[model samples]
Target: MVLCHDEIDAVNDMQNLVAAPSLRVTTVQQSSHTTLLLCSAYNFYPQQIQMTWLQNGEEVTSDVISTDVLSDGNIYYQIHSYLEHKPKPGEQISCMVEHVSLSEPLVQVWDPHPPRPLTERVKIAVGTFFLVVGLTALVVGIIKNKKRTAALCTVMHENLVAAPSLRVTTVQQSSHTTLLLCSAYNFYPQQIQMTWLQNGEEVTSDVISTDVLSDGNMYYQIHSYLEHKPKPGEQISCMVEHVSLSEPLVQVWVYFHCFDTGGVLLRVNIGALYLQSKVYRIGQLYMISKHSHEQSERGEGVEVVQNEPFEDPEHGEGQFTEKRIYLNNKLPSWARAVVPRIFYVTEKAWNYYPYTITEYTCSFLPKFSIHIETKYEDNKGTNDHIFGSEPREEETEVCVVDIAYDEVPERHYKESEDLRHFKSKKTERGLLPEGWMDTQDPIMCSYKLVTVKFEVWGLQTRVEQFVHKVIRDVLLLGHRQAFAWIDEWIDMTMEEVREYERATQEATNQKIGSFPPAISITETALPINVRNGPNSAPSTPLSTEAPDFLSVPKERPRKKSAPETLTLPDPGRRDSIFKLPSFFSWNSSPQPE
Candidate 1:
């Protein structure tokens, strides 16, 4: 039978197989003295299956135990083995069963009571204690971490530590707007502010917007719209103000474009001012501008006038075109004063007008005279009233008037032939005379008419006229010396012309002599004449003459043996008609004596 229960109370439980000779047992609810066991006995094919208890080698069987064959086709036999009294320490109590198929019976025995409850209770207690300690430590650790985080936040707030960094994000330019996206970092849980400053002044409104994060950090996106072009020197600064930092952090960026001035940009030297495109004297700054009247006016008005006309209106910027002048070390005060102003055209172009004045002293001339005489004779001279006088005394007198002129002589007149004669005469005389006498001679009185002319030059007319009349009367007196003075002036001028020509010729010759000749020394040294002939070999001497040794006479005659000596006629004793052979004859041999 199957048994179902919520719980089982047992010290031990045993079940035995009838045909298979196996047994299973369970022990429960037995604290002492009770044991559950199984036993089996085996004989032959018809082996008897039975259980028996042995106590002290004696079999004890009880009726309270039940035995049967299991449904699994195994032989089982069971019998409870109990000691009538508690089992003695040395006694053996066992359950034994016999099976028909085995030679011996199987037996199992155990004490039903055990101390397992005390061991299990101790294990459960230890596990529960460890679990409680682990949970408590985890809770304490979590609380400490929370406190530390709170302290760190407090310290960071006190120190005002904020992360300051900048990065240029997206830059967008639309039709009229410029947008910038930026993120800012600062210590959280505090009040911090950001602002934009344009050239040191705060800009609060008209900037786009700001966004704050859950952690008290902020993201700012700004759009700045421009309605007009920005002026030069205008600047924009991103100014951030926060409680986390002591001072506001400002980043400023300036915008400007290069400009060209349409003026002479001079390379300025040391100790000089570059004005009007030229380096000018420091002292002459005013005078350089003064040369241009328009520039002078502009310089005077520049200080007083707030809005001045642009020097070059077309170019928008006030560009002054420059001019250069090389300065002299020494300059007059007026020139120095005016140079600086006139050096450049401040208003307009400068007009330069130079004025000059000259003085001349009057020269005085002394008195001078000229005289002229005319002689006319006719065949009826005694009856002519024009020459009324005795026949021999009859004469015609003509006084030639001398025009006296005083003033500067005309330029053409001074360059004319007459002035050349006058100047030449003055050089010869060294000085003008106080007065002069003129005379004219009457010739050919038989039938001739003679006329004489005289002229007197002077610085003043009255003196010259008085002198002329005197000269006229002198000439009318038939004086012959007046013509000589006139001829001297003419001759002196001709000599001057000749001298000038000669000097010119001498100068030309000197210039010519200074130059080297065209013919060079190297060319002159070269041989002009070249010989043309077949190259001849040097001549050899003729052998027709005697050997040189024989040509020379010896001082002494050669010695000879006494027997070989031959007597010869002495030239001194021989007759005059016979000629002796020379001592150095060609056929002669030395005599042996």
Candidate 2:
């Protein structure tokens, strides 16, 4: 530990030195004719510094761009200066940095010269060898295995899957309709197929499929949508057929509910019959009706719903979709390899947009990460009156609720400009909330209570943006089959808590490191020593008995009782046996007396 401490201190001291500017000259692949010289100085303390690029001992100010001084989070600063040049043989490039902490200015140089003859010879020889081998292998391969390659291509054409992952998400724009989306991603070849089935029968009409999109890294994704009134026990599935799969991948979802109440209103309760081992966000489920199990079991015909334009004087819920900027996943892979990644890297960049999007069901997406909850609700004060039929004159009010630790957010939510991050709070009695005082379903009596959980790990602070984006993602991602995956709900995991703490600590350290040092250091504690008073007995003798605790119970006294006498029998015989038991002899003698 001591050694580690010393090493850390030594590192800090060394990093505090005036950094020596280093230069790297390299060719730009984008501009084949020009070379770029990069000069960097890092880990220098005392913020004021001077940096300049030099060409042949003369300052080269043109075609040079230098970055603003940036702190490396310890009061030390770093800067990168770039110079683009068309270099000739024997040309030189250098950078100079001047700082008050330095005894002298530091200069670093990069010499650009053509490769040595030996190196040129090695490159030519390797190229020639590879060319000869390639020609020979090409001729042999063509002559020997053309037929085999053709057969494999045929097989692959029939079974290859472009996408490896799938997910479905749903959002309710209104209590009347739920949008279901089917997403497939992490692809190889783009040859793919998709279909939707209701109660095992393929629904042809009202189903829309998207053109396959490429991430440019050889992966592809596509979406499919189905608009219809849901029935219970209705086995809704998105069947994807890919060349790499021998059998089509079929993901089934059933959202069914029944009525068990005999009250004034027919209270409908939703039953989930989805058997697939998949996870769905808890928020999107709110916008759905309980599947009519009896209706589906009896092979009832489902009502086909069409995609009505929300802005068409018809609905306000669909207006949220206008702000959605979709999956722009066409980015290059970090790996120089050919295999595509499971999750799209470009997806994170898409999130930087002002709008938030929900993946109603991107079938293969590992998780749904949105910052909103979606649900169908019985219109509370207005009548149409009070439910999913007609919109009232009032502008649609959408509530973005926080599901505190995956629970309903009826309480402890901060609302600013219509955004909310649900926080867990103690009850009036100061205990963890166990009942539904505030946690009750927002759309209670409307149907099922649905909340869409977002992957809002770092978004708690951005209330307005978080809330708006959440509402947008839900509208865009929700389709007919999007809400099929059963959610695996849990609170904060130990690993997650630890990771959060670790990140917070790092951020705090970085912030603290960038500040100026303390001008006046305070002592850790007051340093005053006192001599003990003369060791002597007290003036009065100390009481020996221990103090009694008023609240503690005292031992009860035992009740005294007389001991009972036991009579023995007399000897059955004078010499061999007792005449009677002692009790009989004692009683008989007493009677005689």
Candidate 3:
């Protein structure tokens, strides 16, 4: 026992002797073509160490030189590494050091931008001196205005609790109607009232809302959805009454000619040439939608397995298209973990101009599907019973997304694309300032009724919620892109737009196919029922048989809830929706976004 204790003490003493490294990275030499960076580590003990260069998180294999660790003669060591490379735009260069003393790798980044010049530094110093002097004089002035300052503080305290941030966004859209979502977020005291008003009158019907819900941070959020069929010269807005505001806050809905699909309204200046605008916007939406799918780097991404645009006399007038978005590799990490590696979801759309019906179904899951009905109108979104005489489900959740005011992912943000700052020179429109919706002329809204279903018991709620989030993101991004790139498509003809879509879709399909795990194309006839008209949902499949990886498990049921042993749904059942197991009822209401 004494020997063991002595060994432990010796190890502890050795650990105590360890010294962590101090790193300094500098641009040692520079030329027009290449720059050399030197990274030095000082005063690190326990001689064994490793040093390397990294560019944007990846290891730098070439153009690297390292010096052997040298003793500092005071029980410490020093090492230096050199990296030489041509500078690339937006490339981050870093030096990584690993040693026995470090709990994790030590990194030092090289800043390409040089330190401030002496004159610039002197100017900043002078500015600071004047700023301090001004502050001192301001203090004297504040003493004379002490009573006024106190009154201002009292007003601030009375008004500055928490004011709700408001944004109106389109949750769903079709040919002639829009479903608008008005959301109020991050307010305190929990006493707030919201109302939808059209043309200065309080709207009484077709409004669905969520009760105020706590954000768990002493703040609350509520969402209200207004279904409206927009008309010419009509104004629609959300009125919020909160204690933080001295007066009620009003947010008007702005319907810009952001997208020019069939039923969407446009300014009369263009006259009958509006069809060109509609075609142009459709092309823009397709391109933007395609770009969103390419963000995933883990898999091959989305593939257009089949795209068939046809005309149906039964559906009346406009075009009908069936698109298959084969998402073999284009799935979120959470979904990809459980789904078969090779799977796809089918989309069928019946575009009848002012009204449209779109449906989504997954082949492998069989029980999961999404159905959406959309209508467009010339006024703010307010349309009730547009779908059918059937009463809409009261539990349906409405999410409003404001493209101009709502926050998008920071990585995707672009200054030129920001609606608050961007203005269209050709149309003399945009630069959408606060309350821009109140006065913007030629307004329209798209109303969409979305329904999602997942019959698997354990995964139903989670999957449905995830699908909604994904849908919202898609809608927000698509609308933002349409507005931002309006100039590119505002003048395109219908034929020109169709050609652009064809070329882009071909390029996108090629890009997905070129990725790892080579893909082969096969032709198979879809069921006749899949080609059936707009009223019925169809079970469409690219292939009849499941891949070998999707074969059922042989193990007997042992009370496990997984669907591994379950048989795939019969493709013959065309009209029947997947029913939930009687024991499992999904009563969970949708959460507000």
Candidate 4:
């Protein structure tokens, strides 16, 4: 029963026949210099209309009050809006009303200068009759008065509201401490509020804000500073509130943590992808921590080179380590044809239990990097604002990979690794049937934000897409294996797990290559595109020296088309997880107790 446009209009007409609104612009004396102006639209049909107050034909936003549409008890409505202002000479105030009944907006203007009293008019007429010869002198006086009125109006217009411009910057005070500055300028009115937020939570301590200062013009400016030590994957923002803005202005400052490993300074670029890990309680965390290490040690296609544990003043309570995953012969034939025989991707991680940050970088591709920020919680993946309140600059697309239902790669799939076929003997948590996610108990989810960047022009989109596929595969394979091999680490203590890491790291390093180089490396400024503006470089990471291993080859390899770039084989029955919509039903589930 779809109605045509004409029929819809006819129905609307029958329900709410056109009735234009009556508008009025009136003022009340508040003080000797101030006045309250009200612009009201009355008795409009359909209860929908718009009313705005304007000065000199420009719409006003500040010091305005409005009333909701009140019922006239006859199926009609009325609304009022007000603007309080100081009386200014030569200024024209108007009320603009818009409704469906009116062909165009109706504007009723109020004249500042009104007619004089009848006595004064009569006296002026008598004088004019007697002094007819002096009419030229009167006309010259009138022209001078008009010129003065125009000049006054120009000055009044200049003194109206001005919007503010905001800028945020970072300053490095020491190796680990950073200073963030948020500044807003060119705004009229001295009143403004500025505050600092870390991961969307306001920070009252260690924050300093300057008094709103005049800019010597008719505008105001203010500066806010936040002094802090660096932490992994922290988002700091400065929010400014002013009467000039209908909503508060927010400026985000993302903190990038840098640490030295061998002769390389690793700077992590932050990104996020929320992935679900359906497991019970602490078992989920242990499985993630231990299985990741075990997989690296057991893999044949890749080798784990260096695993160095380090201490940092900022992240003292957490585990800080650097690792290198050497990809020598693992590259596809097409990829191997265009690169050096020796190639590896560096992996640096800061593990703080449920909160962890891992970054991957390729020495050869200076413009490419992968950052992953992970947060573990004992609930369904519903905490949308766990990362930050402000929306990210990039559009976010969500992918839910059903480990049991989604198909796995043929070459890597194992009968033991299949979640639908394998069951755990000790925990009795295996042999997950179809739609098992609906009834899974004591569920926990791992929210991962994976950000990948490839700045090369033609290869950017395709390469990024491919890398995400590989990441999703890695996650899918790793989690599936974790559950299948749950008996291995379900009973290990924290100390035992640490000892296991030390032993396997040694064995893995021996299998990969010789000991890593120990040259000193200095921090460097990120590329201009990564920075917010010219002054965005924070003090701590002013500049970074290239790693020793990133030396230029004697010859440049010709660029080749990426393998499977033109057309990739269908991965599985389900579409690639990247192509999925923005959300899943499970994402809206209630927070787990």
TM-scores for candidates 1 onward, in order:
0.16, 0.24, 0.44, 0.40
Encode model 1's per-residue lDDT on 135-233: one tens digit a residue: 999999889777655544423334444544432122212112222323354334335455666677876544432233223122222222211223444
* Per-model root-mean-square deviation over C-alphas: 70.2, 35.3, 23.1, 24.4
Candidate 3 per-residue lDDT over residues 143-242, each given as its tens digit: 9878765654433334446899887766332233455778898897778999999989999676766567566455777777665666656778998999
Error of 2 at 206 (Å): 1.3
Instruction: Mark the regions of model 1 whose C-alpha exceeds 4 Å error after superposition.
Output: 1-160, 167-170, 186-190, 214-231, 256-593
Candidate 4, position 508, lDDT: 50
Judge candidate 3 at residue 215 and give its lDDT: 62
Clash count, predicted structure 3: 27
**Location of the lowest summed lDDT over 10 successive residues in candidate 2:** 584-593
Instruction: Judging by TM-score against the true structure, name the best candidate.
Output: 3
Candidate 2 structure, TM-score to reference: 0.24
lDDT of 4 by residue, 524-547 (tens): 323435422222211121122344
Which scores better on lDDT, 2 or 4?
A: 4
